[model samples]
Target: MAKILVLYYSSYGHVEQLANAVAEGARAGGASVVDIKRVPETVPEQVAKNAHFKLEQSAPVATVADLEQYHAIVVGTPTRYGRMSSQMAAFLDQTGGLWARGAFNGKVGAAFTSTATQHGGQEQTLFSVIANLLHFGMIIVGLPYSHAGQMSVTEIVGGSPYGASTIAAGDGSRQPTEIDLAGARHQGELVAKTAVRLFG
Candidate 1:
């Protein structure tokens, strides 16, 4: 059995939905333990509320030390200017000690993200998060072509060979679609399965 952690930073709740789907998939993929947690919010509560951010997230905030306890870690974030949000970046930046210790070495790592538009650099954001995981000496896993839903032409969905994603509208009115959530689940399942094979 693999222990998996779904860690994410969601400003408008879209990534949070994907995080939950990822956890669900990990459970279905034979993981004995799956925990979903969110990174700390960098913005002040008043600012977040003024900006209409989803402030009442249910997942407990995770600390840098938490990364050491998981066999696999799946990260999710929203794209900010074709990169990861500062909140997520700030949280990951604190992992330098873990990097030096190789605490996550040889573990499974995967990334997922959301963008405000179809051309909003979803893949770039995924890479940004994956790059941090690489620095932690993790084995990278990506959303593969086997999840054929990414090829759908019927809808404006988000999923790439880099990772699963969803296109949240610019006004933050759009939520993840079924296809987007499925892609997140597929990536999570793959991550968990890979961890089981590597660690078990």
Candidate 2:
């Protein structure tokens, strides 16, 4: 059994759903504990007036200290110019001490994201998150080809070998599809299983 944390920052609720799906997958993967958390929003309320950001998210705001407690971490964020959201970036930026101290060394790490378009920097943003996890000395985990959802062709959705992702419309109208959630769950299972095998 392992403790897995699903942490993310979602602007329009899509990533929130993705986070839940990932957590569910972790639980199903035989983790002893699974927690879902969110990064504090950096955008000023006034600027996000029409952004449709979910105001009632229930996930607790995550802290750098929490990362030290989890056996594996699965993080998600919305795309910001082929990168992770500034909010998530800000939270991760505060972990410099943890990085230097090897606090997350050997822990499993994975990432997922949502974008406005099918090709809207999904892989780039996923890898950007992965780069930071690598610096923390964490072992990277990804949704391997074993998950058949990675090869979806019936619809334009989000899921890659890098991680799980979803296609949100430009107007933030689209939600994650079945395939997207399935992929997210797969990533969670992989991370949780890996964590348990290594740490337990």
Tens-place lDDT digits, model 1, residues 155-176: 8988999999999999988999
Every model: Cα RMSD to truth: 0.7, 1.0
Each candidate's TM vs. the true structure? Answer: 0.98, 0.97
Candidate 1 lDDT score at position 187: 89
Candidate 2 C-alpha error for residue 18, in Å = 0.5
Clashing residue pairs found in predicted model 2: none
Clashes of 1: 0
Segments of candidate 1 deviating more than 4 angstroms = none
- Candidate 1 yields a Cα-based lDDT of 0.93
Candidate closest to the true structure, highest lDDT: 1
Q: How many residue pairs clash in each candidate?
A: 0, 0
Model 1: pairs clashing at backbone N, Cα or C within 3 Å: none
